[model samples]
Target: MSERKMCKFYNLNVPDRRSGSGDGGALNHTGNEDDDRNEDEGIQPYVPPHEHKLEYSYWMWFSQRPPTRDLSTTTTGYGQALRMVGRMGSVEQWWGLYSHLSRPDELPPLSNLHLFKLGIKPMWEDPANVNGGKWVVRLRKSQTGRAWEELCMAMLGEQFMVGPELCGIVLSVRFQEDHLAVWHRTATDLAAAARVRDAMKRILQLPSTVNLEYKVHKDCLRATNRHEEEMNHRS
Candidate 1:
């Protein structure tokens, strides 16, 4: 069965739209007031006893590339090393988690923040993602935080109209450039893919000058594997 059909059959819940909400856009390493405020803005995170439930539960995963590791071997260990930051089923819970976490700018190089639906792991080999691909937007270092925040808000708000086709989103932190990618269920569905791409561009307020690309999971895996092979040969 197609991924979309399967999702509908199971009645998987994505994020719900927040009515009449404006996007307010995250880090800190110090103990000073400025650092404290910057990290969480003094908003204490609270979990409700039994109210304000979200449409779906989500998991947040964090990973940082290991130093001196070969790219091919990286996936295995990297996947293993991913730490589950938290799981939330409500807006309060998400806010609590988001408030305490380090901002994307404060993250170390090669770090990544992944927010995927509760049951799906953020990996190319995962069943939900194996048949999928990502719509990636390259951004300058200065632009990463706002774009990430906007994208996250949009996802949690269910602003993207493609039903079931949307899987998750990722923000990758790099040395010189950062990337934000939207994962979807099928690479072969050009129409759905186009809609998703357009939604992302519109929701994220991406300018025409920004660089965006759609890459199938298989092709992405191939490219990484090829790079790993080259690195191994050089060693």
Candidate 2:
């Protein structure tokens, strides 16, 4: 069936009345024609026919490394490259977008996928995220796609029990190592942050031997700016 028709059918099967900023709010909904389709799932023949509802809607954003004259310039322009790929308030909507899009493994090196609550931008500059920080877990390239999928599912299902402090989740694909991080709204709320960290560890099934780092958004922004300055000086 055509994607549009399939969505209509799914929506008809399960009507939803719960409203949130993401469900009724303005969104960018832009996307590319190419889709990634079950590449990581060994070519599944069937996709479930039921619709699922999430607590809140989310927006998907994508970014890729930018081209530069110098091969070693490393000017990814991640912020500038980021663009809204789509928005999903319901299970059918999410599946429609995710099923067709390229997986993290299929994306180009240095690409990123950000899924943030609707009405909130994925950037640290967003008002909801400015004072926040992210709990990060670095993973080998081979481990990223499945880990990312599980993380997204967990967040959407509200499995973390992290409360309203949960902002979003990001998957950064790099040449050396990929990363999966969950953003929360406060850096100083150690108690809340600890709860979030523990929930994250449990949901992701990380071992006690693994270490996760939480970086404040302000610190990340500062480091980014400093790197830009150094690159400009060398240029």
Candidate 3:
């Protein structure tokens, strides 16, 4: 399966379609010559599927922990470390960007990939997310790839039924275990949050033993700082 994906999409370094560019042209990773192509050029090696516009535009972001530092230390600095890799306005754009990313298991430890609604930064303290919270579940490395894929699909498909409350989702790659999380606009909205929670459970199909946890953004702010201080003291 992995081998086949390489043949179909661009590699990790490939950039997404530049916003407002003409012809929706993207970088062509495939070696096909121009003569065989139609006037429309949007980085697809094969016969591209019909375009489908998404309800909301999304941004693809990536961050890797440097050897000397840990990201858990501060909310403010965490945003500084993130790099916006792509923007997706349509389903085709999503795949065009996602296909190039390293698989969850293949990612280096301490790396993260984030897909969030456009204009809403992934950080918990962002105005769009400051009052919101996140739903997180740890999974085995083996389960990370598929689960992450399905989660993103559900988000893009609007299956959560939570109506613009969701801010973004993340895949955290670590040494021993991986985690998946989805952030929302308001933790206080119990009915909406509950729907988001139920939708996550159904989509991930997590086993009974697995725990799904929710953390409020404001609460996370103080706790995260305290935890960072403790770790610093220990070091």
* Candidate of highest TM-score: 3
TM-score of 1: 0.73
Candidate 1 has an lDDT of 0.68
The residue pairs found clashing in candidate 3 are none
Ranking by TM-score: 3, 1, 2
Q: List the residue pairs that clash in candidate 1.
A: none
Candidate 1 structure quality by residue, lDDT tens digits, 1-235: 2222211211222121122322211121123523333343222223356646656566676766656665325467667656544456677666766766667777777778898776677888888888999999889899888899989877777788776778889999888899999998899999989988898999878788876898999887777777777776898
* Runs in model 3 lying further than 4 Å from the true structure: 1-20, 25-50, 67-72, 226-235
Task: Give the Cα error of residue 20 in candidate 1, in Å.
Answer: 38
TM-score, per-candidate, Cα-based:
0.73, 0.72, 0.77
- Give each model's whole-structure lDDT: 0.68, 0.68, 0.73
Model 2 lDDT tens row, 1-235: 2333322322222222122221321122222223221111111112234546567877777765544523222324554555555566667667666776666776666667788887677777788899999999999888888889889888888887876889999998888899899999999999878988898888878899999998999887787777777878988
Better of 2 and 3 by lDDT: 3
- Per-residue error for 123 in candidate 2, Å, reads 1.0
The residue-by-residue lDDT of candidate 3 on 114-215, one tens digit each, is: 888877878877899999999999998989989999999999999898768889999998899999999999899998888888899999997777789999
